[model samples]
Target: MRRIAFLLLLAVGASALALSPQEGWDLVAAVESGNQEAYARLVEAYQAGDPEAGAALGVLYLNGVAYPRDLERARRYFEWAQAKGSGWGSWGLAILYANGIGVAQDDQKGFRYARESMERGYPGGKALYAMFLIGGGAGLKQDINEGVKLIQEAAATGDPVALNVAARYLASSDLPGLSRDPKKAREYWERAAARGYFLARGFLAYDFFFGIGGPPDQKRALELARPLVGFEPAATAVWATALYFGQGGLVQNRPEACRLAKDQAKLQAGVATIYGLCILEGVAPGERALGLAYLALAAAWKHPPAQSLLSDWQKRLTPEEVNRAKELLKNLP
Candidate 1:
């Protein structure tokens, strides 16, 4: 959704003739300052005939940013703009259809609109179309080579999302035609992070923590991960791990770290293992039994470290204690 909004902003900037030069500047300021009333007034003033204004207003309605959430109204505005040959409107409608926001979910129709938008030179649509081609979804044929080329082209436009995607492809060692180029991946991630892509920030934080493509910099890892704790689950786990070990600037706080690990365990298997370890080590008071139980749970999930630890633990426990742990595992959520 953030990517969609970014693309819409780009489209609006490109079509600035929708309003007078002064009004366009005011609209940009209003958007930057999040002045909803000013934005609404400008959108109302130009929406009748300006395709750009119609597309922007549609996005505002779709997201309900200071306006009531009205999918039907958004669809109407998108359709109006698309009829006026607005590529952004085509992309917007494609998104709605793809996600079933206001219309029935129809991947085929969504792909058609996306293709149309891309053909009309919408960079966002090109990126989406590339993804569709790569994933072979929406009845599109899989063409990894072509998809890579398209994404590279889109990245050349300095689209942050495209840069992120390109970085992932370039960094993946498992992809058949791509080589793992950590240096290039770091460059792409840095560029995207500078453009405010939080996802890229999380990737860079992981790299910094693990010293991938560079020397370990725990301080930089903490700096990048701190603000993303609540917003990015993977970063939260990284931050918690760093806090637990005091590797970064954070002071050691095993209890808080254990709590954070436990909270994130369901979303990340590694975090589950970390939580189990915290419990097994008695890092927090009164958690030994539950920690063993969590270790059992992680072993059940096929985490190798947890499996090894549980195996050793079982050797030290009596049959009755083993039965109790099994019972606890059965009752675990």
Candidate 2:
């Protein structure tokens, strides 16, 4: 009876380990595509000690993507993967520690883990560690040149996050040892956009609209900006500005522009300034009080243009009206 029971336990163990790596990959793909049944199977495989599945499960729990957010569970799965010596597991732990997700925030621990993962040749870890080096946070020495080199190397691997960060660094003039190069920025942005990064599309739209980095392509700008409207307020603000000025092959429509500007103002201080200006100038007509309120709201947020406008207008209002505007500003969310 003892031998029979031992044989039965062995059979159960073999059955639990039956999933092949290829099958695991397929399940991972299915989970990414939002198949709940596949996610369940993958979870089972993770429980059986499949390191890749464990790491993937950790990410899902961390991000709260398909699974409910459970940072503790995420940490456990990451620990399992780390026990298996997975580089990605180290990277996962680094992120959690850095962000204070599942445990007390420890930047030094995070940086150490990130460096270890990078040394182990994890792509995400390389980018993350390079970022920390660039910013010089968490006791790491600042080295912009070295950081840029690492970023460029990671970007060359076509990782979407790396592509975006590298593009931004290339476009920014403020970074030491890096000059703003619109053409180069556009190249990286284009690559990231092709890989379906939506923010890249927004950046490209802004660039095309403003003639930044390349000759302005108003038509292209409008084409890119139109589809992103409603969902991307910053992009919407750009499109609305273009529409107000009749640039980018769009017909001038002050009413529509004002409407769009007002819609975006709640989310962006710059848009609030635009909306206030439209009201103050009567571009929206018969809305001076509304304009003052909008300016007050923007000014409260420390927007420079709104503050400048408010300073100039303060002299025009009676003390009572100014107090009323101040009250409105205080109440703004």
Candidate 3:
């Protein structure tokens, strides 16, 4: 009787195993290959018990890439996947908590789930865990050496974002016990640039334009900057500098330099924006000059050469007049 009962149980389990790859799992495979119809089909065919499908749908809902943005639904799906022990589920949940997206921001919780996913060998979790460690500082007690090591591991696994960040840290003056090696920095930046990292291109252009630790090569700088055109604000400033100084074989063109500076003023947090905000905050017009504007601001504050300019301007006026001018620009209206 016991043998007969065990045989019957085995038969039922075999029948269930026969349909292991469900229709929803197939839909996930299709979605991964960029099949729009298949993705939609998968979303429609997803069953409550399908963890992979749940994780995919959760990501789509979370990002609002195509489907309606639904945080609650995303959370539900992520939770379901978590219940099913999905690595991606844990990783997504960590991101939501870390970014304060549909949840209270909690780095400790984020780190916990991220570490869980990382331990399971999720490459993105590794990168993200490293970023949280690097960026949180005192909140997370940033350990640059440990962060660099983890980032390098992620970058080696072909995380493009990780590649750029690791390269920057390797080149950064802020990393303790890490001596400056421009060539090493350039090497990592080049690796990232090859994978279409626009920011890496911008930094690489700087090295070429300035001949920093490498032979001056303006042509190479221009080449690096060319593909990154229309995207980088700081790159625009660098390009403007090169144009203004005729450095890296660039022809000096004041008009183009002015145009770039004007364009930069429109950008968020650019040097031009700094001047504009300073003016809007009550600094007078022409009180600040463009094109190396800081030099002029320094001069205005009576900083050495700036002091000489202030004295010259004062010679045309009196101390009372200078005090009156200071009073006029004293506070933001």
Candidate 4:
């Protein structure tokens, strides 16, 4: 059987086996960045029955990095790798089942796979399972305390995903006994960013941009944010804000900021507000109507500032302009 062949080949693939989990992931990232040599080596490893390489291949297919996105192929590679006892394989399956990536969403299956991955000492799996416990999304009892405990346990290992989750929990104020602690969140995010977690970098960049939990470091903020502009929405928001305000050594580019926000903002409330503000203040009289339209979307997203701005804009603009805004809103996606 294929599984038997994998087990047998594992002995011959000591090179791949020697890599730590983080190093395996670093190789995947290299391939994702168009390193053909890395990709060739990974493929060679997989052909030689390296479970970690197989899992990395799954990641490539899952995210369309080196290969076109093919969820079914990803699943197949994951299954093969998991059969060989690769934690990354189980983690991939967990994400697929948890979010309905290629098949019907099955929270129970996701939870089971996440547990398997965690048992294998994968920090992402531990953090993921912790989320399922916290949200009770897997048809099980909710255990916020247990979930928080799990996050802390995983974070102690210094994995970026686990650290990011810990930061999120620290930042959340509505969870029963857990008070908001921006300082702790900032510290965790900084650690996660150092480990190359782009989302965490984005958050820390935002914090630096605005002096949250620390003094503003505009230079550092731009350094952390510019590379992530097209990759993470959080970074997009940071870049948009920075460019609009001419902060972080960036040239003031109100028009470019709004342009950057146009498509990316529809789903990001904060970015929508920035786009709306830019349009309102910088655009022509007629185009200003669309600014209110964008602000209205942000208001619908439950952004308090957006709602306040909407009220002010409605009061300041003429009735005709308000009607135009309404028309613009209807046409926006």
Judge candidate 3 at residue 158 and give its lDDT. Answer: 59
lDDT score, residue 141, model 3?
76
Order the candidate numbers by lDDT, best to worst.
4, 2, 1, 3
In model 4, pairs of residues that clash are none
Taken over the whole model, the C-alpha lDDT of each candidate is 0.70, 0.71, 0.58, 0.78
**TM-score for each prediction?**
0.55, 0.50, 0.46, 0.68
User: Of the candidates numbered 3 and 4, which has the greater lDDT value?
Assistant: 4
lDDT of 2 by residue, 1-333 (tens): 999999999779747754533344355446756788987777676676667677667766754435666779989988888777766678778888986766999999899888987787666578778889999989888998898778878777775446666776777556754467878888877765544344566677767766767887878877766656644554676677776778766888877888888767776555677787787778886435556777878787665567888878777767776676666655543
Misplaced by over 4 Å in model 1 are 1-125, 137-140, 263-273, 279-333
Error of 4 at 278 (Å): 4.0
Q: Compared with the true structure, what per-residue lDDT tens digits does model 1 show for residues 1-333?
A: 999999998677656546532243345335535777767666665544777567666655654433666889989988988898877678778888875767899999889888987897766568678878988989888998888778778878775556776776676544554467877887887776654445567777766776766777878877777766744555676787787778777888888888888766655544666776786677754445566677788677555557888888777667776777677766654
Report clash pairs, candidate 2.
none
| Pairwise TM-score winner, candidates 1 and 4 | 4
Regions of model 3 farther than 4 Å from truth: 1-125, 137-141, 174-177, 247-251, 262-285, 289-333
Pick by TM-score: which candidate is best?
A: 4
**lDDT tens readout by residue for model 4, 1-333:** 999999878776666454555666666668867778877777787777788788877776765535766789989999999999988789889988986778899989999999899999888789888988889877868998988788878888887768887887776555643457878888999987764455677788877876777788878988887766745566777788888888777899887887777767775666888888877887423277888888898898755568888999888888998899899888775
